[model samples]
Target: MRSLPVYVASVEAEGDRDETLRELVTTDDPDLAEKPIVENFTTEALGTGLRSLRYTQTEEDRTIVAGVRYAWRSQEAGCDVVVIAAAPDPRRILGAMDDIDAFVEQITLTVSSG
Candidate 1:
């Protein structure tokens, strides 16, 4: 399968990852699914070595469905992560709101010829 083309922006964040994440989670939408926030934060793993946070957020939710992932790619680690939220899908045109949702999704797949 072919990979989807994603639009990404550079993010360089300074501060505590857990604290920033919590603030982002709350500031962005305090009512978002707790599972995404409470259950999925790997702060311990993301701590210590993290001097500065660098990642990209999804920027496309204009035409696609909701509850879809807005993502960020850890440039140093080569890991792509999603911010658990969906931007409004009313306009197909990209905007600041769209930029808030960085575009990138990573998946594993195997190929076989039959």
Candidate 2:
């Protein structure tokens, strides 16, 4: 049995990055809409033309989750890459942020330019 919400991180290829991001940020769940977003930011980094965003949102049950998403265009890879991390609890997420950031920094992508 899982007490905490199951938040999964994933990366995939997609056509519309902004549209996908908007879908993620906009809360359709009535439970989550009451409070809305707490804070959010976006930037490009990683030296591979990577774009990323981190946002925290208030859940319907009054709990909160922080999420990070990264996207980049890759020709040889056949599509753009999108990476996501969904954290259900701020305290626990914050405590692990340092380790998380370090781990993310190690991710390397080789996109071939044809």
Model 1 C-alpha RMSD vs. true structure (Å) is: 12.6
Model 1, range 1-114, lDDT digits (tens) per residue? 222233433345546555554444343443342233232322222322111112223446323322323333343554443344333342322333243332222222123345
Q: Candidate 1 clashing pairs?
A: 57-101, 57-102, 58-101, 58-102, 58-103, 59-101, 59-102, 59-103
Give lDDT tens digits, candidate 2, residues 1-114.
223232324346465755654445443334442433423332233334332334445655655665544444444454544455556655655565555455555655566566
TM-score versus the correct structure, for each prediction:
0.28, 0.45
Candidate 2 wrong stretches, greater than 4 Å:
1-60, 109-114
Candidate 1: segments with Cα more than 4 A from true spot = 1-9, 27-37, 41-84, 87-114
Worst 10 residues of 2 by lDDT: 1-10
Which candidate leads in lDDT? 2
Instruction: Tell me how many clashing residue pairs each candidate has.
Output: 8, 1
Q: What is the lDDT of residue 28 in candidate 2?
A: 38
> For candidate 1, which ten residues in a row score worst on lDDT?
47-56
